[model samples]
Each structure stands twice: as structure tokens, then as C-alpha cells.
Target: MRSLVLIGHGSHLNGESAGAVYRYAELIRERGLYDEVVEGYWKEEPSLRQVLKTTRSTDVTVIPMFISEGYFTETVIPRELGLGHQGPVPGEGIARVLGGRTVRYTLPYGVHPSMSEVILARAHEALPDLNPGDTALIVLGHGTTRNENSNRVIYQNADRLRESGHFAEVHALFLDEDPRVGTWPEVVRSPRVVVVPFFASEGWHTLETIPEDMGLTGEVTVFEDHPSGSQTVYYARPVGTHALVAEVVLHLAEEARGASERGGDEDRTHAEAWHAFMALAQEGVRLGEALITPHGSLYEIRHALDEGRPSDALTTVVTPEGLRDLTRQDEGGRHRPVHTFRNLPRGWRAVLSVTDLPQGVHNLYPAVVEEGYAHHCHSLRATPWPTTARRQTGIYAKVSRATPEQVEAVAKDVCSRCLKTRLWAGEKLPRTFFTRVPGAIPCPEACTYFIAEAREEVSGKRSQGGHDHG
Candidate 1:
């Protein structure tokens, strides 16, 4: 069996950061090329460390959904996947024999040559009527001085676009380094300008920061009385969110799969764990806000609040992707990154064959089945709050400064908002930080959202003259 895993850099503040990755995974799954297609996130649940546990395939190819080969691609991902410190192999990625399976890691999607086509397509689609010869195109990236490769792909694409001669002028801009995005008004001399974000997904950067920095009022911002003489600025969506990204991912995975050497028999750990979960589901199981009930060979999952309703009465979803979209938001349309949140909207049911239950449950509450099985086997590792906090840097570094009382306060506040049973607690927090419901989903550590809130509380207290034990 073969599998494809798409890794993304999810966000604690914005749930939309992983949206493109999930969409791409779903699109690829629809093609029925691989036995399994799953998604992992660096900052979200079903994280890079745990995603492999959900795949039963012997030949697994992992493609980072990021736009560049930077810190995450080079260091963090390998570390999380237990792939050791092996370096890339020119075109083919690091291949290793892991737990009786052949796992091949591929470069990020953005570095591929086909991405230039995606960028051009997005630019043209944004303003089909505009003449490319008269408009200047700017590719925006989040460049970092720490990793030169972070901006390398953006420059390469800009050069490619210049070679295409489709645009009158092409410029590459970064959010962190030189020729910043804010200087786009001065950098391009064309009467019409198109700015395409080279990042993955629409998050705080694309949705909020980039627009504010570029002085863009909307998708098509027109400046009637500007210093550049009535310039019209057209902003395209991030290149990574384009539909062609799924094709790029498949190409990357197929390339790695062809180069990979088949090894020992497939590991049955993940498959066994999944089967065990299915066996448990046969009787009936409550996972977070979802209630799974067996109906002979098939199973029906619905919101716990809608347990009494018939499947036909609720909004029925047959595919895992459809169920994922349906439950991505709450009743009021707020994004729910923490899927185990108690606020699952009422009157929605998912009908799945036994074969589809794994993906279906994963979309509803990621890694719940695998983690639950590990917990049952007494092998699940939970990261303590202090350990998770000490690993934080940058804006979240202040989280380590939180007092015991402040830590407990933040834990209580955040846990109350989530449905998962906390398995990791601080020194000050009791084992029962919150009442653990029977069949409650497991939270192995303090989530990114909780950490962000803790950082805010710590920073606020410090500003208010709170004593710093550190």
C-alpha cells in the first residue's frame, strides 16, 4: 500500500492556515492514486509527530505543503518524524527504513517548476481583461535572514515570469528582508500592478498583515489620486492555495515513490490500531462531540447533540472531505481549529462505510483513533505544560514567565473552551483540571492556542507589574 502525507504550518491565531493543505489532500484523495492521503500540521492537532501513526501504507511519501525549503523543511519536520539528521539527495528526498516501512521525504511544493505556471495562472485569472504587457507583477514572500532558501523560490519564480515576457515588469518582494512588500508602490512603475502572495494558505499574513502593509483596500484596489499617477493595484490570492497545487503535490509524491526502494512487509501497527477503533465503533463510541453508532457493516456519526435525530433528518455528508468542511466552523460560522471544541453545530450527520471511517473520524477529530488506542495500550506520551512552554521562542517566549497561579488560570480558561480531556498538566494544576467526560477526546499537550493565550496572560501581567519569578 502507498500513502501520501501533506505537512503544513498551521496557525494558533488563524484556523485558515491549514485550509489549503487540507483542500489539496482532499483533492488528491479524490483521484484515488494512493491507498491513504492524510495531512499533518506543525502547529495544529494530528501534528507532524503523530500523523504517521494514522497511515497504514508501507510506502509513505511526505510532501511539505510549504512554499520554501527553510527551517521547517530542513530541521523541524525531520526531527518530528524521527527521520534523523539525513540531508536531501539532490532531487530525490531523504529515504529511510522506518519501523518496517519505507518513508521518503520530498521537498516543499513551492520549489517545483510547475509552481511558476500556478503563479501565472493565478495572476491571469485575477485580472483576465488586463494586458499582461502593461501590468507589472510582484511576487510576495515571507523571507527570513536566517534562511536564504526561504526567499530563493520567490526570486526564481520572478525570474521565470520575467523570462516569460508576459508582464511589462516583474519584482520579488519579501515581508522580512530587503525590497519589502510595503515598498511595492515605489518599486513598480507600471500603471497597473498585480501582487501575488507566494505563501501557503490564507492566514493572518495574507488576510490581514499583507493587505494592511500594501495599502490594499480590496482584491482590486484603485488609486485615483496616488503619487504613482492613478495606479490600480490588483491582489491575487496566495499561490499555494491555487487548485493546481494538488497536481504539484501528486507529482512530488509520485517522483519520490518511483525512486523509493520497496523494503520489508508493511507495518500493521497503524492498521491494527484502526481496526481496534473500528471494533470499538461497532458497539458505539463517543469521540469528542461526535457520536458514532454502528449499523451492521456501516457506521453513522453525528453531533452528540443530535443523537436522537435520524440520519436523514440531519445534513448528511457521505465523504470525509465534505464532513470536514461541514464541521470546520461552529454554528455562528467561527473557525474551529480545535476540532474537539464542544461547539460542534447541531443537525449534521456523516454516513460512512467501514473503509471510510478512519478518514471520516480523522477529519472530525484528528488523531483521535490512533491516540486513543495508544492511550489504551499505555504507550501514549504526553508533553507536560512546562516542557511545551520552555520550547517556545520569539513572541511566545514570555509564556515561560507565567506564574503557577497564572498558568492554572490560563489552563482552566482554555480547557473550558475545548472538549478534549487534558492529559498534561502543570505543577499547580490538579489531575482534574477539568472534569474528564467518559469517551472524551485526549489532549496530549497544551495546544498552540492555549500557549498563545498563556503568552498573552503572561505579557499582560508583566506589564501590570506582576512579580517575575524567572
Candidate 2:
């Protein structure tokens, strides 16, 4: 009997870590794809090494049910299966001389483009009204700086989904990397949100860590009290647990069978594969700059300047003084408070000819996003704001004429005291520190320390908590 062993990064803490893996294994076994379909786990029994011994088949196919080509896929799996190498051969898919039987290892299923179909399905399943034009789809990933290659597939998939333009925005959020999952919501200018875990299986990260951090309770949950409306934040199941992944596994095994028959001459070694993947990733990043970057996106424009490649497309630089001038005289005959508009397309004209929001304000949205998913713009400055070009007026502002040290002291006090109290009380504080006066580039470099609750009474339009004005 040809044996198939599904290796999962089982959790000692989350008993459900291996639950999906076992379920899929049974599904595959019932199809008679392999005589024996058993699971091995790193943190659960039977251990990978021990499980390999139990496989009586001369032909054994071991699949790593992970989302990336990380340490687990390349190093740990080979070492455990006694493949006698630190690296794997990509596209070859077969390991010879492993415990005197032919072993085949498949590419991490998460990398396959087919997974996008499953993600889209999950989003649609959770939200039947999921509109790509207005909803932001965040593919939450387990990005580790450990191996730069660990998240290539994640970025690729995110971009892949973005290319479809299904959601108003599609971005990858890493638990470990910038644009972390915890605060992406604030940056997303969407009326609806759908977060799909890029993990192979449903476990603590998907079940406990994500929902707790996101202030979510269940799948297809609603994030009410949004300033905009009762917006929905759809939480989808892990991509791996999707029924289609079994087909990906079967496809990988079939490819391995082909490579095993052909004798592995054309395959690149694991190190070579990593290098190739890196080169591809870097090249993709280079090309990605042109397409996804909307023209008037000040964040990307600043990023270019910071990188020393200020784009010619960024000709209209709105300085701090320019912003103050714009704010002084408004069409409403009232001085409009500083608000922010981000991810603006190049062709988008300013709605209200107002002052230039501080450059620091541009950084704020990106910081919240780069930090991770947040409540759709949970108010740090005050409840009066808009992510869209539609600006809200008369936000209570506390500008500081004090020196930088004074500003820092106030910020420290608010951050240290009020933030701690709110956190301890299990209330979610805004994931960002406010640091700018509307329209004015103040004497102090960073001095907007508005440490109000996540929200205060704005008006009948919005309340202390709720959706952002997308």
C-alpha cells in the first residue's frame, strides 16, 4: 500500500491544531489514494520520526500542511524523515534512499495559486454580500523575518487577489511582520471587511489570537458601532481546512509520482529553490510598485522619498504650510479641522479644498495598518475623522504650542496611565498614538497627544465606538 503521511505543526496548547489535518487525511484515505493515511505532528503524537516507521508502504508520500516554505518545510521535515539533507529539491518532489523506501515531499500547498479560489470561496461563504469594490480583503499570514522566503507565497497570493480587484483593497497582514494583522482595519478604506487566515489549519492563532485581538467573537461576526454604519467584518476559516485543499494534496502527490518515475534530473535543490524564490519575490516587489500603488497615495509617495527614489509622479508636494493655508478659509465659512484621506488614487481630486493634512497624519494611517488590523479607524485623536475624502468638521483639537519635551511628557503620561487602565479593563485602545495638529506643522516635531477614549460623543452621526467612515 502506498502510504501518505500528513505532517502538521500540531500544537501542545491547541488540541484542534491537528484536527483539520486528521479530518483531511481521512477524506483522502477514503478515496483509496493511499493504503495508509496517517498524520504526524511536531508537537503531537505520533511524532514525525515515529510515524514514518509505522508506514509500511514502500512508496511513502509525506506532505507538510503548512502555509509557507519555511524552516518547518525545508529543514525540520527533511531531518525528521531522515532525508539526510538540510535542503530539498524543488519541482523534483521525490526523496530517494529515505529509510530504504522512496519518499515524496510536496510543495507547501499554500503557495499554489489554486488556494486563491478557496480563499475567495471562504469570503463569499461568510459574507454573501461581499462586494469586491467596497470590501477590503485581508489575507492574514504567519510572516516570520526568520526566513525571508517564508512569506513570498503570502505576498504573491495577496497580490494575486489584488489583481482580481475583487475587494476595494487586498493586503497581506503578518502576525510577525509589518502591516501586522492586528491593526490593518484602520487603514482599509472599505465599508466591509473579510479576513481570511492564510494558515493551513484552524488553531489558536485563528480561533483565539485573531478574534481576541480583532475584538471579534465568531465567524461572520459584525463589528458594530462603526462611525460609518453597522459594518461587517467577516472572519473566514483557515484556507487549509477548506475541502479543496485535499485536491491540492492529491495533485502534489501525483506530481511527486511523476517526478519519482522520471528520476529527478530537472529539479532544483532546496537551496537553489530558495534563491530562485527570493529572486522572483524581489522582482515581483519591483514590478508591484508600479501597478498597485495608486498615484496620489501619499504614503507610497513618502515611502519613495524615504527610499531616495522620489517619483516624478509625485510632483505636487503639499507642504505643512500649504496645509495650514488651506485650512484657514473653508467653503463652510468655518475652519475645518484636520482630517486624513489615504490610499487615494492619482486621478482622485480633493473633495473639499481644505488644508494639507500634516505629513505625520499620512504616517499615522500607514503605521496603524503596518502595525496590524484595528477596529475600522477606532478614534485615537477623537471620533471626528474620515478616511475617505468626505471630511468631518468641528473635531475638538488640542494643539500644543509647547516645546517637544512638553509634548513628549504629555504623550508619555497618556500612553502610560490612561492606556494601561483601558487595556487592563479589557477595553481596546486605539492601536496608534496621535501626533499631529490639523493643517499646521507645529514647532514640536510630534505633538498631537489626544489620549481620549477610543471614542467620545461626536454627534448623532457617530458614537463612542463603531465603524470608520470608509
Choose the strongest candidate by TM-score: 1
Q: Per-prediction TM-score, please?
A: 0.80, 0.51
Question: Clash totals for all models, in order?
Answer: 0, 18
Model 1 residue 225 lDDT score: 70
Model 1: worst 10 consecutive residues (lDDT sum): 426-435
lDDT of each: 0.78, 0.53
Q: Write the per-residue lDDT of candidate 2 for residues 345-370, one digit (tens) a residue.
A: 23211111122221222212212211
Q: Candidate 1's residue-wise lDDT over 114-203, tens digit each?
A: 899999988988888667657999999999998778888999999999998889999999999998998887778888988899977776
Worst 10 residues of 2 by lDDT: 436-445
Question: TM-score of model 2 relative to the true fold?
Answer: 0.51
